[model samples]
Target: MNPLIRPRRLRTTPAMRRLVAETRIHPAQLILPLFVREGLTAPAPIEAMPGVVQHSLDSLKAATADAAAAGIGGVMLFGIPSTRDAIGSAATDADGILNRATRAVAAEVGDALVVQTDLCLDEFTDHGHCGVLDARGLVDNDATLERYRDMAVAQAEAGSALLGLSGMMDGQVAAVRDALDAAGRTDTAILAYAAKYASAFYGPFREAVDSQLTGDRRTYQQDPANRIEGLREAGLDEAEGADVLMVKPAMSYLDVLADVAATAQVPVWAYQVSGEYAMIEAAARNGWIDRDRAIRESVTGILRAGAGAVLTYWALELAAEGRV
Candidate 1:
């Protein structure tokens, strides 16, 4: 049978496919997620995440400089403090590891790239929860909001251009927005983790941040079973003045990402989280797949699913490859 319309014509050449690509990824649209552990003298490789590392302050600056040079969008910084507490006091201290790293990065490449910090207590809290627990040993929502408010101001003061609010607490976006506005840091922006799911896929991330968690965050993070609730959460964050909305563990939540991206008035981004990254890297190392091809295809799928940008560990590598 002869078809009048032929889709194979467009697939004939690489250039033709490139020219017709509906979802193209630019280097400037890729945000790299970085981790810096306090007091480290050198970069330490993360075992589960193979090529990724926990950088020292000096290494962090060097890495950020490299990222800026690569022309990638930005770097999202996560700090592993030398100390932890019940209330995550260091998260609000100007001299804290995260804050200090933020200041250094901004000084090094603020003019070239967006400097973002993880505005969550999980890494700083001894309890391994995103928020402080009450006397009953359960997460205290309102108390957590209070802590987030303080953390927002601190991150802004430390020169973070965007605060990645990953603590999925209720009213978090509003609380942080109000706090930032009141502090006269009106220029700082919030990237709400609007639809972060409580998935087992975050297992490698726990190791990356040295998470002290004994249990899980299923109480706060969205359940994987609910799709409509993702839209609801994204809408709430947007209504609360989120400058950007993100869906985490992106590959597993493409439906949620698409839904949010379709309706979000603000930029919608996705996180290619630690577990997702580990799966590909591990598989590739075992010769089951082409490493480079898998990396490109995975990100392309995420972008095609409707993410305006992606926070990935491969931002630098992709940017250097000159095509993604």
Candidate 2:
């Protein structure tokens, strides 16, 4: 090695490093995930997640408009129903909170930003599972696909530009795609939660949605130990016509995100879930870290790991701060 060829030369200053940075985060590369709860008169703060809120219908509309104004690429909407049942009948109702919110947001934004909806039953189901349960109380994959089919049509009719298939069911992408095409919704896109893991990091999310899941999601969500399985799932989703592939709990699964990005023909996304956001907030509150820099570093790390886009609770704040 030549002494004259020091690598630290590029790291000598912020401007020098900025000039040679390989990855950059942009507002368009951020997707905000919003929770819309039925029966809420106003926005309700999620205590577990400091800055995030469960928005009422009117608040959801305003939030989507703010997201559009912030120049974020999209917003992923998750619905929290007032009542829940075994089959989640509310999910397929056009008048349900999610569908209604979709229509409202779409009307407000009008293609200025992509309006997407979470295509899952967990929030609507009293059992708090992603799929309909069987006699054995296990998730029925094929049965859930049928529900997803109905949900796809419902979301399409409600003006969801992209459907977030997050239930982790087999053949979901194909089933939903066929349903959308059959309904003459060829313009709608699918965002596959291809590598979502069964993670402890989702604890705050359960609180955010008021989930009552008694058991675990190990049967459907990928195990954190199984990196190869994640890639396999991504491949399957891609083969089934997923327009975008995503890895969940992004901070811990940067490896998964990077691998998926490398192999996926479509755009690869990552979800910075609730626990990730809460941890950062908790630390920043105690002054354990620099809040602003930590936030940027956390998201920038995900981007550098190869996510084309990231779904983060911090999207709005980051956009306002011009960090993304």
Candidate 3:
């Protein structure tokens, strides 16, 4: 007697499974997110996210070289300034940590990979809001756009190939685009963080950046419960000249990612945020999960859900292991 349907035929061997795989992860599809702190003689390790560090400028150059050697598509830089103010003055300072880091990394690997910069005020603001606060203590939206314009030009002038606009402010894409063009940085691209959610998954990132936040960003970041809103935000950014759109906290928001990827005119990407990395590392350390398999599976799942590329802390490690 013969069974009419034997689906196991496709799963019979490793070679068969590999040949039938619908999704694959590649080094060129990974973008590494790196942090560099001002005035550090040595790299400072971030406690919440194991194995991730805030690099000194020198160390940042070394690391960026390694990323380029690994064949990753790009590196996204975040700076931790020694000083911050209500308007995040340091963000637009040409000699600020982030800008200096961008220059160094671009010089080191700009010819080999895309050098990107985080274009947000959260890391540079004394209040830790993504934008300036109004007199009544609310984040002023229109006012923030003005600041973003300055930041766009600064980051572009510093040699960032792509400006990651992760502040989630209204009209940010348009403002930044116009700023870049006016500054004659017509080649600088915008990576709009279109659907960054107000989620607990960003907890570890605060530690990484030494965040000065006293309150949640619920007023600006998209609510975690809204999937359709992600699409709407992405659409607005796309129409406003965004070269790429990003959905943050990738794993929990696969539905939003897939939705955005389905119709976006430009490429769609996902950020496997700090909390997701910490969780996997924590579980692996506890012997509850196979670390390598988990990493591969997690990223594969993101790609399967339609992310054209992924920004992950694991990019280097995965590339080193030849897993991507």
Q: Using alpha carbons, what is the TM-score of model 3?
A: 0.99
lDDT of 1 by residue, 1-324 (tens): 989999899989989988998878789989999999998999999999999999999999999999999999999999999999999999999999999999999999999999999999999999999999999889999999999999999999999999999999999999999999999999999999999999989999899999999988889999999999999999999999999999998999999999999999999999999999999999998999999989999999999999989999999889986657
lDDT (Cα, 0-100) at 176 in candidate 1: 97
Which digits, one per residue and each the tens of the lDDT, describe model 2 over residues 2-54? 69778998999988988998888789999999999999999999999998999
| CA lDDT, every model vs. true structure | 0.95, 0.93, 0.95
Candidate 3 clash figure, as a count: 0
> Given candidate 1, what's the lDDT at residue 146?
98
Residue-level error in angstroms, candidate 3, position 292: 0.9
Native-referenced Cα lDDT, model 2: 0.93
Which candidate, 1 or 2, has the higher TM-score?
Answer: 1
The lowest-lDDT stretch of 10 consecutive residues in candidate 3 is 315-324
Clashes of each: 0, 0, 0
- Look at candidate 3 and tell me the lDDT of residue 212: 98
Angstrom error of the Cα, residue 291, model 3: value is: 1.0
Per-residue CA lDDT of candidate 3, range 27-139, in tens? 99999999999989999999999999999999999999999999999999999999999999999999999999999999999999999999999999999999999999999
The per-prediction CA RMSD against the true structure, in angstroms, equals 0.8, 1.3, 0.9
